[model samples]
Target: MIVQLSDIELTARTLVMASQILVILLGFTIVYIAFQGYRRNRSRPMLFIAVGFTLIIGVQAISAGVYVVFDVSELAAGAVSQAAQLSGLICILYALRMEG
Candidate 1:
């Protein structure tokens, strides 16, 4: 069966897709900047922070892909992304304590 979208619906979906791509790109940029700072400072805690940002990037990209492929609810997708982000941050905190 063929699916039909109104012009407004098509435009909205395109905009949502564009925003998701921008979010993914910006998240990776953050991770790259953090990694570069870690390299320059030789700081393990900064490395952990970079790792956390990497996880955030993964969440952004994977959650968007999941939403597109599986049509998950916004609440569910946000929950999944938040859980990943929290996990990464907790690990980073632990690494920071160890570095201290």
Candidate 2:
């Protein structure tokens, strides 16, 4: 048996790309909003949120690169992206716990 680029795979990949675009854009917007909040009243939690979003944006970019540039399997890309996402959240949690 042989396999070719079928319509289903193409459709799925297109959907993934579109979602990635939306995720990255939303992450950037979150970071921007957090930055503005931090700047307005100089809040520590807002700073942590901004930093978290920055890390999240980086992770999203790398995940998309793996999907589009490296052409990794979807499962592998999801695993890597999930790990990075968790790590980013952990950092933010630590930041929140620490004294500022």
Per candidate, the number of residue pairs that clash is 0, 0
**Model 1 lDDT, residue 83, Cα:** 90
Question: Which ten residues in a row are the worst by lDDT in model 1?
Answer: 91-100
Question: What are the RMSDs of all candidates, in order?
Answer: 3.6, 3.8
Candidate 1: tens digits of C-alpha lDDT, residues 41-99: 88777788778877877876898689879979989998998998898888678667875
TM-score of 1: 0.70
- Which ranges in model 1 have alpha carbons more than 4 Å from their true place? 66-82, 91-100
Q: Which ten residues in a row have the lowest lDDT in candidate 2?
A: 91-100
Best by TM-score: 1
C-alpha positional error of residue 83 in candidate 2 after TM-score superposition, expressed in Å: 6.1
What TM-score, computed on C-alpha atoms, does each candidate reach?
0.70, 0.67
Writing each residue's lDDT as its tens digit, candidate 2 over 1-100 gives: 8869899999998999799789888999989998898899888888888888787787769876879888599999888788878877976897688775
Model 2 global lDDT (CA atoms, 0 to 1): 0.83
* Global lDDT of each candidate: 0.82, 0.83
